[model samples]
Target chain A: MYKLIWHMAWNALGRRRGRSLLVTLMIGASLWGLLFMEGIYDGMTEQMIDNTVKSDSGNLSLFAQGYRLDPSLDRLLPDSLLNQQILRTNPLIKSRSIRFSHTGLLATAHAARQVQIQGVPLEEEIVHAGLSDKLAQGRLHFGSDGNGAILGHGLAGKLRVSIGQKIILSAQDRQQNINSLVLKVNGIIRSGNQPIDDKILYMDIEQCREFLGVSQGFSQLSLILHNPDNTALLQEQLLRELDDSAIEILRWDQLYPALLQGRQVMKTFNLICNLLVFCVAGLGVWGVMTVSVLERLREFGIMIAVGTSFQQIRAQVLLESTLLGLGGFILGAGSGVATLLWFVEHGLNLEVFQEGLQAFGMDTIIYAIIRPDYFTTALIAILLACTASVILPLRRLKQARPVTILNSQ
Target chain B: MDAFIEIAHLHKTFETSREVSTPALIDVSLTIPHGDFAVISGPSGSGKTTLLNLLGALDSPSKGTISLGQTMISKLKEAELSPIRRDRIGFVFQTHNLIPVLSARQNICYVMRLQGRSQQEQESRVAELAGKLDIEQLLDKHPDQLSGGQQQRVAVARAVASRPQLLLADEPTASLDSTNAERLLDLLEQLNHDEGVTVLISSHDSLVINRARHSIVLRDGRVVADHYERNDIP
Candidate 1:
């Protein structure tokens, strides 16, 4: 019975190759649309995590309790040695950075934009801040004279400051004294983040201490863990080691609510795109099945009269639908992956939208990233859509009577 | 002779969209002895086909008792009716109705396969039937490749391939020329005589009515005349 039904299905498909191919292509295009959006979402989220962890917050951060809200000099960590020891003892903490951050005056020929000055050990900052790799011009030099600073590219443009140009930074210390220093812009960095690009200034730890009037004290310590999801484990271990009164641990989500919110918006946008794709694909399935059923009514009637049971006939139709869906998914997945790989290797240049994207805090260039799970999900969705479309036709099959069908002519 | 098929008090009616009921078959009863060649004659829309469908178990009468062999078919469900058709009944249609995608041999062997007959048995039976029908040379030909007569011969072979106890034919020679129609009826008569297979055919052709061993005439959904022949006329 199965063999007979299969033969019938095969013959039916062969008899109408052009229509079958058209349906398959429709299904394939739908799958490709769904997978392409998913790939972009996956790629963007991954890039966000990488940029956040490698360039700024190292997966997680430890800050004094009130420092996140105030971000003032008075919220400086009393002691850095205990937190450093705690971080070092935890094997999950792959690397760590201790820094003092404050908003202060930044002067250049073009402008004097208020900037967030991050003070860190020059060598440590180079390794953990993703700063050393982003130099747009000149070199990073933490001279022993304590008079050098790194400016973000966008900030440098606004400041009209170039390499070897003099800039002044001013801030009040924890002791309530106004401290000022003159510094040379040793380098310009481009981090691809609009906020970071416009407001970041980096300097040597000793120089920052002198400018901020902080004597050997740090405000926050950021740790890069091997796995960011192990936040609970790392927090527990750090609490056990550090005196809770002097030190506090802050996860990245708490430290960057805006960034997290932005990510959530992007996720919701992707979900909407996914829903649209599903709807379009499901409609394609329904359209194709309905048309095919109508076109093959005579064939179906003949099969019924030939003693094929309703259940067997329905199974045959479902099998054909499933095969079509599987074929489409294979083609669509292949096309989507190929397109993503091409984009990943050669990113799409959005020079036309550069200004607008910059206004929205996004990069002009976009790269599509393909993930294994996205492909799996797309395939399952296609199969489900195909199955769902065939249900109506299968029900129709149950009510079909051979006598009525044969007499229709 | 023992009745091989008995249909008692059969009634069937169809309702149209305007809510008017039209009778297709009414109080029609019939009995045929084993190995007898029976012809049901009627005008267009006179319900001969309806009675044939009821007897073949393709449909149930609205009210009647139909017995094939020892089984009461009127109360049987569609699922149960299919196996009875597969194993006990053979059908030949007016237009030869061969599935165009399959070769003549495949069409002939289809019912035997449905009956779970072995491949060897199917092959032997198909060969014998096709040879008897003079279509052995055309077994591999598709329906479109055969003439009207050849197509009907394949249909006849298909009908008897499973060696059914009864054969129900609906205008088996309706599409054929007189020569081909005569040839097909002759083949059906030979099968009835040689295999002891009871034959009931619904046809309007005068040739078929004159040749059959038993005749039942229908008019306006009711049987008006029934006759039996004393001698075989080939």
Candidate 2:
């Protein structure tokens, strides 16, 4: 009986091939589009989070309790014994980099512009941070000279200086006195972050400390954790260890809430788009099933009159809709996943619109990534949409009088 | 052979217009015993089809009782009526109501399939009925692919393929030509005489009534004439 009912369903589909294909395409194509959008959004979120955490704020940052309020040299979190103990004893800390970050002016033979000076211990940064990977040109080094320096690529372009050139930087020392330093352009970097690439500069932490005339002071201690998610727990642990001193521990989300909120907004937008697509797809299924039942009413009446049970008839109709839904899902998901695979290999480049995207803190190149659960969830959603679509036609079946239908045309 | 169908004071009303009820079968009673070759003849809306619907348990009567063998079916729910329709009664209709999607053999095997007959049993019965009806070569063709007569023959074969205790046919030859109609009537008569399958056929065709040993004629929703003509069958 089951085989025969399936046979009927199959034959019915074959009889109306165009309508079946149209409905299947409606569901499948929309589902594919939804999956693709989800992949791109996920990729964008991952890229943003990685760039923010690895390039700027290392999963967590340590500051003096009043430093964020004042941001003066006196407010800096110096190398305290208690803070060093907390940083060393924590198992979640994978690596650490110390830096003295400040804004200064870069002067060349023909140009002078505002620039950011990040005095970092280069060796520790290579071990702990993704800063080394953002190098678009030259090596990630301060050159052979001990007085070597690195310039953000955009700043180098603006200065019209290249490797082996000399530049002058001047900033206020810790004592509110102006100090000047001359360094060679050892290397240049572009971290795909516009603000960072355009104006940032890098030098050794020891040099920065000596230049600032501070014997044992560091501006910030950036902690890279083995598990970034452990940032909150480690912060709480550090607070516990310190007994509420003048130290502030910050997680990546807390340091950069804009990224988090942007991701949330995108997620909500994707969800709304998915709902709209599914609604249209579901309506297509309902329309096709309605027409199918209407076209076969006489056949159904005959079957019911000749002892095909109503339940059995319902099964055939349900199977027909299921088959249609399944066809669409497979078509959509199959093509969608294919596109996702391609995206995982060669990322989609938005270089033509790079300037527009850069203004919004987005990358020029976007890669797509998807979890397995996305496909599973799509299958369940499509199946439900199709199953619900059959309800209207099945109700028609339930209310039909075989005698009356048979006696009429 | 002791199986019988008894209908006592059957009534069916149709709502033709607003706040008006028209009677199709009015206080009708009928008894069809085992192995009876009976024909129900009538004019349009004369309740011949209504009586057949009641006897087959397809519709509930307005105010009467109907029993097939010992099962009281007039008041039974729709759910209870299907098994009787599936297991005991088979139907053949005027339009040669073979499922257009299914081939001739599949249509014949449909009711037997519903009865949960084994594949081998279904195949053997289809072969036997197709051979007996001289439609063995038309088994693979769909209903539309066959002639009016061939579709009717396949329909009759389906009605008997399950070896049902009762076969209810409504205007089985109404759409056929003289020759095909004659051939179909001859087949029904043969099934009744040979298989002892009680047959109740409703028709406007004289050929149907002339071929049955007994007949009940209805008019204006009443049984105006009911008789047995022994000479008609032999």
Candidate 3:
């Protein structure tokens, strides 16, 4: 029975070869557009998370309670022996570092600017944050006394400071006293993200502590876990091990809730775009099927008159539509993936939107991030849309009377 | 012999529009004994085709009983009627009505295939019928490639390929010229006489009516005349 249906479908399609090809191309183009949009959006979100976690924030970070909302010097997590003990017990803790991040004023030969200053131990920062490899200028070095600093390229330009130039940093201490220190710029780094490049300055922990007049304490401890998804599990473990009164555990995702939300909104926007593309494709399918059915009305009548049941005729129509849809989806999905790869390898230059990106703290270059799951999702969506578009034609074929159809022809 | 087909008080009304009801057949009854060659003759719009459809079990009467073989056809569902049509009945239409996609041989074998006959049996039967119908030369050709007379012969071969108990043809010779019509009627008459196949044909062509042993005339959906000839008139 299945073989008969297939043969009939093939014969039906063969009867109108030109029209069938045109319909297949229309469906394939629409599917490719929708799949491409969804793939790029997924890729971008993945890239954002990877870049963020790899550069500064690890999978999880620990700070004093309320430190994220208010990064005052007074909210520093008091360094203690018990904290070191808890850090040792977690096997999934890949690497841990202490980072003191705060706003400070920097002055160079040409100008002065406000900057986000992160102070970490030179060796640990180099190992955990890949900071040494990110240097685009002079080599990152920790002098024998550990007092040098690294400025981001954008920040260095704003302050007109080059490597080997002395810059003065000033900030208030936990005791409410103003403290200042002079340090040589040892290197320049670029992290792609505009705001981070424009406002971040990295220095050794001792230098940061001396500048802030906090000789004995650091503000936060940042831990990088093996898996980001286990943040809640590790957080639970940390809570059980540590005294709640001493420090707080925070996941990087929670710290940047707005970023995650923005990413989610972008995904939803892409989904809506995909759906719109599919709707247009579905209209094309509907048009093709309606025309095909109308053209084959006489053939359908003859088959029914010759002993084909209504159900059999309906199945044949559906089978033909499904075959067309499957072929289109395969072609479209392949095209979409190829297009996404080309875009990913050569990113889009959004230099014209530099000002807009700057306003939103984004980079000027946009890269499409492709993933296997995105392609799968797009294929599923295309198949579903194609199947849905055939409903009307199938129903029409089912209800049509052979006598009327034969007479009509 | 038992009546191979019986119809009692058959009525068919077609609703052409929302408010217009046209009667195609009314109070029409018929009985065809086994091995009888019967012809139904009437003018245009005289319900000949409608009656043929009803007799073939392709349709149902509005209010009547139709019994074919031992089964009441009017009471059977569409799925059940298909098997009876496949094994017990065959039909031919005015246009040769061969499935254009299949070859002449395939058209003949299709009914046998539907009857779930063995491949060997179907092949042998198709070969024998195609040979008997003199369509052996055109067996591989599609219906579109054949002449009207040749196509009608293939149609006849296909109708009898399954050795059905009854064969109903609707104006099988109406589309052909006089010479082709005569050839087709001759083939039908030979099948009726030599093979003992019960044949019922609907036609207004006098050439066909003259050749049939029994004739039924219909007017306004009722039988106006039912007569049997004492000798072959054609």
Candidate 4:
């Protein structure tokens, strides 16, 4: 009996080729637009978060309790923290980099700007953040003399200094004495992080320590965990074991709340888009089904009078709507998956908006992420829409009097 | 003879959205015996269709009781009436309301399939009915592909294919040419004598009325004449 009803539903849809095709394509086109928009927007958001994590904060960062607020050399995390057992033996910590940062004046022959000078161990910095990949021009290595410096592309642009140019960096030492050092630019980096690309200049840690006369302390220690999901767990364990009075532990999201908010906003936007597109698709299904049922009132009446139960008729109508929805879903999902796969392999380049993208800490090329839940959620939503779309029509069918329907004929 | 359908003081009214009232069937009482070939003749709005609809359990009467065999159907809910309608009654409409999407064979086999009959049973019954109605060649055609007579024949086949104990046809011959009308009357007669299926048809045509073994005449929603001729069966 079910097979017969299914066959009938299939035939009914096939009979009205134009209307059925119109509805199927309408749903397909809307779903395609929705999937493409979601994939690309999410890609853009994830890329922004990834850049912030890699170019600046690792999964987690540690600092002196008051250093974030005052950012002075006096609040530096003592070098002894590096010898902590968890820092060296814990498997959760993938790699760690110690950074010394201080606000200083950078003066070139033609231009001068105030920038943050960051002292980083070159080999460890490369392993932690793929620093070499950020190099836009010149070599990533400093000279054998350890006097080479790398400027953020934005900072380099402001000073109009390319590789091989000599620049002077000046900052107050730990003894309250002013110190200045002359360094030649070795590399320029564009990390696509707004703060990093706009205002930071990197130098060798040993060179910076010698120049500033800071022999034993570092400002911050950033840890990259093997599994980023374990960051909070490690933070919790560290908080229980370490002296929280002297050091503050912070996750990447805490350090960059705006990036987290950006991700949330994109997610909500995608949800709203999904609701709107599927609602319209549901309405499209409703419109076609209502017309189909209304036009067949006489036939339904005859069916009812001949002992075809109202339930059977209802089943037939529901089956028809479901078939149409499935047709649209298959078409839309096929095209959507293909498009996402292509974009994943070869990223979508938005280089035309390079400056705008950089301002938001987004890379010029974005690779899409395809999760299995996307297809499952869409399938469930579409089936629900198809089922909900037929409720009114089925009620109308049940209410229609067989006598009146038969008599009208 | 045992009563196949019993009606008592049946009344049906139609009310418009504006609170206007019109009566479709008045306080009429009647009894139809098993295997009787009957006709209800009346002018339009005289309640012939309304009477057949009530007997078929397609609609409820405004007042009184209708019992098909022993079950009181007038007060039953639609869900309860569905099984009675499906297993005990079959209907043929003037427009031949064949489902447009289904081929003639599927249409004829629809009700039996709904009853969960075996595939072999549905096929054999469809084949037998197709042969009887001279629709064997047209079995593969959809309703739109067939002529009016062919479609009406298919409708009759669909109506009787399940072998319902009671068959109600409203103006079954109203749209047919005289030859087709005569052929349909002949088929109904064969079912009545051979299958013991009680047939009730609403019609105003003299050709249909003259062939009935029992006749009821209505006017102004009231029965004015009813009589029985000699039974040809038994």
Q: Compute fnat per model.
A: 0.18, 0.55, 0.06, 0.82
lDDT of 3 by residue, A254-278 (tens): 7667668878898789878877877
Please give me the DockQ of candidate 4 compared with the native complex. 0.77
lDDT of 3 by residue, B176-210 (tens): 78876786777777777777778899998889888
- Look at candidate 2 and tell me the lDDT of residue A146: 53
Residue-wise C-alpha lDDT for candidate 1, range B1-234, written one tens digit per residue? 788888898899887767798989989888887788999998989998888878877676889899988899898887777778778888887777787777899889887766667889989998888777789899999889999878988988998888888899999888788887887888788888888889999998999988878999999999998888655622
By summed lDDT, the worst window of 10 consecutive residues in model 1 chain B runs over B225-234
Per-residue error at B234 for model 2, in Å?
Answer: 15
TM-score of chain A of each: 0.92, 0.92, 0.89, 0.96
**Quality of candidate 1 docking, DockQ:** 0.45
Place model 2 in a CAPRI quality band. medium
Model 4, B164-213: lDDT tens digits are 99999989898788988998899899998899999999999999999988
What lDDT does each candidate get?
Answer: 0.78, 0.82, 0.77, 0.88
Task: Report the Cα lDDT for candidate 1.
Answer: 0.78
Candidate 4 ranges beyond 4 A from true positions = B16-19
Alpha-carbon runs more than 4 Å astray in model 3: A78-86, A132-138, A142-147, A160-165, A341-355, A358-376, B76-80, B100-125, B134-147, B177-183, B186-196, B230-234
Residues forming the 10-long window of minimal summed lDDT in candidate 1 chain A: A79-88
In terms of lDDT, model 3 sits at 0.77
lDDT of 1 by residue, A223-329 (tens): 88778789778877778877677667767776667778877887788778766776787778777777777656665665555565667767778777887788788
Global Cα lDDT for candidate 2: 0.82
What TM-score would each prediction reach against the true structure?
Answer: 0.92, 0.92, 0.89, 0.96
Check candidate 1 and list the clashing pairs: none
**Runs off by more than 4 Å, candidate 1:** A78-85, B113-124, B136-147, B231-234
Top-scoring candidate (DockQ): 4
lDDT of 2 at A269: 81
Docking class of 4: medium
